[model samples]
Target: MTSASVPLSGPRFQTEPAELYRELRRDHGAVVPVSLDGDIPAWLVLGYRELHQVTGDPVLFSRDPDLWNQWPGIPDDWPMLPVIGRKQSSILYTVGERHRVRAAMISDALEAVDPFELRGHAEKFADELIDAVSGKGEADLIGDYAALLPVRVLATLYGFTDEQGPGLVTALNDMLNRTADALAGKQHLAASMGQLLADRKVTPGNDVVSRMLATALALEAEGSGSGFTDEEIVQDLVVMFAAGHQPTADWMGNSLRLMLTDDRFAASLFGGRNSVAEAMNEVLWEATPSQNLVGRWASRDTQLGGRRIRTGDLLILGLQGANSDPQVRTDGSALTGGNSAHFSFGHGAHRCPFPAQEIAEIIARTGIEVVLDRLPDIDLAVPAESLPWRPSPWLRSLTELPVHFAPTPPLEATSA
Candidate 1:
């Protein structure tokens, strides 16, 4: 079948794509043809083993979008441009020496962050957020809680003020949604980051932004071509902001949904039969927030999962599809404690930095725990099955998570 016949990103996949993935796997084995934006052809890797092979073999399958042979024919205003288009400063779009240099700088800056301290801050933020909504009988968790926690924590870590949090959220959301004014949002975000970088340069602090600036300067002093400019620093910060907050927010929402809807899983956690970590792992395995990853281009003509691949052809890694492969694990159990085999955060040299995972988990777990503790009687305001999902190829986000809980007095009359 041709890619034009398949719809990979739309309302159908948004609400329930698992059945479609299963049918595709059955008909095409591990690798299947799919279309992005309805006409852009690409291969979707669905097998657990096959995804590993492709991500691990950078020589055969490159992460550089510059290698995309179809770029010349595609228009600049393509709907997927924000995702698959190449950016000279983005580590996500680079390969080889460029990737290695930028990745190291980011890794070093992240390693400097103390996980324990970060978790403590996240917990405090969680408590404050809960306090704000505790007095209300109901809330939209996606908006009031899950959505704000991550961005707040990230802003604090990046040395941004509380006043700036809302704009950051708006900019990041617009860019992710690829809205009509996404370009304007990007420009606004860039201007904000540039100003922040300037402020940090004048007055350094213990935040990630300061650390990255230091590293960039050091690389420049060493005469390394990988040295970062102010513009480049701003780009990396944008990446961190988008990558850090969006997935963590979705993960928090997904985990809470599981606890509220799945009796077996919730019982296991509340009955002391399983830990929160176990529940989180299950969410990662079954309903990964970032359902698909973009832009892994073919370095040369090669075969993958028994399918012919030409040089420059794009390959999209179906993360959720691979984790749910029936051949990998049967019965679809959610209580499979602490299994780290899933590709939720990806694998190999290009795997998400360890610091990102640690911070995201701490924020999500702490945020969820605070809500459950403060509002022990929380339940879905509407039937779980009727809940709608945002129609995006990358994220598995609920449009809203309406929930009800017992009314209590706010800890203080302040906005979260």
Candidate 2:
């Protein structure tokens, strides 16, 4: 890290990040020293090989943001507090054997989700969202469809009523965008989760929270006897809801954007489902929803990508940068499907759990399929170059994905 560190600024990081990432790699090699909003320093790991090394070794690259050496300088009202905070009890900062048990609890609860039921919920929500704007003959898919779908399914799966989904979505968006309302949003979400937990304790249901609450009681059977508390479960739920919603929503929007604009997918968009999966996979590699992750700290002084990282230094996981690392994509033609090696999901034990990944996939893919089924003639409402993306260093999402389609009738609401 040096005085010449990149300022991590500009709209280019959002609108056209690929070129920016390329330049960063060219000038600074794999791990570029960078400055955040307040000139706070960190490393952005851009090399596929280096990112693999960083994430693969949990001991060397720690997840505890408290390990950050710059923390003492961070203020009480810092904007990045939500992204990097102290005293957060979520599983994200949990370490060692405790983290392993927590991971198992999460995995077991998610794995228990009946695939048929999960898909059924996804399809239900997708159809309902599509039904909203179908009659208009045109819609901003990002707002009308993509952004509204995932969290609804997730909320329902977590025992929240259908009516509660919209409010949760609003709160989550505010929280993730890191705006003035962020703390309020976080408080709102926490309140909602608290309410749900209280309700489930009184009378459990067939949902993720109910399962987690029940399973947390059986920690001895789950590899630990100490177990966890209800507040801990609430924190985990908040993390799960935040992680699953926005990225999956963006995955749907990004994939649909790709299908609508790219000629390779245009031919099949209206006729068949053959190209849907390929387009989704391509988004994972090229325009991954999670562009970067608020990330690992150096457990000790170490050298990565030829840069000396002092103990407790922050290292943000540059997922998109790593995926597009020139060394890995030497051919540069871009991968389609059947190649799941992308860092879109993090690596090693601390990675997004497989079941959670599957849930995101189901929500995203099902939303795309529903749109194609309902709006067969969907096309970009504006020129491809005019499409706007949300400005953020962490998430890659469109501000709006406007599209026009043949007028269709809205479907009547029905029980799933």
Candidate 3:
């Protein structure tokens, strides 16, 4: 069949993106043709093996921003990504070694966040959420609980008041949703956070931002070759907030939605025997956040998957496809096991660092067993088919998930 004739089905599963990717691998194999706006031609790599080979070899599929700048289809004025001297993907554009130096400076701050401590925080939040939903007997878990929780945690850590976290999330979502509009939303949020960081610098508080700023200042004092500029630091702040909050929230929401449908998986996870690792792998495999292609431009003439790619060719790494490859799935089952090697987080040097660990705990701790223990009878208030799903290429989230359950009892009075 011609490339255009390849059937493009919508996302697979009630909550998994892997099945959709598996179909792509079965139909297209290594490289699939894509036609973007204006008939721009590109090749999407749909095999896990191929994506690994390309991402690991940065020399072949360079991360340099100039390639994106030179991409043919992007409009001269469009802002799908913010414009700096280089591409938004460029480390320098975000903060380069300065970012690394800042990260190092705050290493102590981050290290202070013991997983046990974070677990306490998450459990408290989850408990309160369960209590809230219990009374209604039905809750839109994604809206009523899941999405709000992580961002609140992140905001508190970052020195933002709990009230501000949701606003920041809404702003970031707006930017990401309007990505095709040339990132106007990102620019707007950048301006707002830039102001916030400057205020924090002058009137420092005991929050994550203050700690990071202290780290930045110490790095500057050491005469390091790499230190973040004020602008770069602010940009990195925006990145941290966005990167930290969204995917995990989406993963939790999706995982909960999926488990509500499958009783066996729910029983094992919430029963607490399964370590957090098992829950994480399964949820990440099931949700597959980085479901869209990672865009790269050919640095030079190269042959891949037996196809010759000339200089300036765009190569989209099919993360979703690789994660769902039948070869990657154990016995072709959706159950997370030895063969489940999905790339919900992009592979290699740039894989998501913090959220992977933190979110895994949230999912592991807030499993079917946990939910059932606290809020049994929590079934879909409406048919799964009635829920609205977000349409972004990179990730998936339910716009809403209404669920019915028992009301939580009122908290008893306690002696101080």
Q: Pick the candidate with the highest lDDT.
A: 2
lDDT of 3 by residue, 1-416 (tens): 13552322244533455555555555656777664444556777877787888777766776554665345556665433331224553243333344344545544555546466566666666666666666667777777676667756665666766556666666766664554543665776677667767878999886667776777787788886565567766776677666666677677776676666555555543444453345556666655555564466777888877667778777777776766666666575666654445677676545455444454455345533345577755677887667777755456677788887767663331111
**lDDT computed for candidate 1:** 0.81
C-alpha lDDT score of every prediction, in listed order: 0.81, 0.88, 0.61
Model 3 error, position 29 (Å): 2.2
TM-scores, all models, native as reference: 0.93, 0.95, 0.80
List ranges where model 2 is wrong by over 4 Å. Answer: 1-3, 178-182, 220-225, 413-416
The TM-score-based order of candidates, best leading, equals: 2, 1, 3
What lDDT score is found at residue 355 in candidate 1? 81
Error of 1 at 307 (Å): 0.7
Q: Where does model 3 exceed 4 Å of error?
A: 1-20, 69-73, 76-86, 89-109, 128-131, 176-192, 199-207, 266-279, 335-341, 354-356, 363-373, 410-416
RMSD of each: 2.6, 2.4, 4.4
Worst 10 residues of 3 by lDDT: 83-92
Tell me the spans in candidate 1 whose CA falls farther than 4 Å from its real position. Answer: 1-5, 178-181, 267-274, 413-416
Q: Of models 1 and 2, which has the larger lDDT?
A: 2
By TM-score, is 2 or 3 better? 2
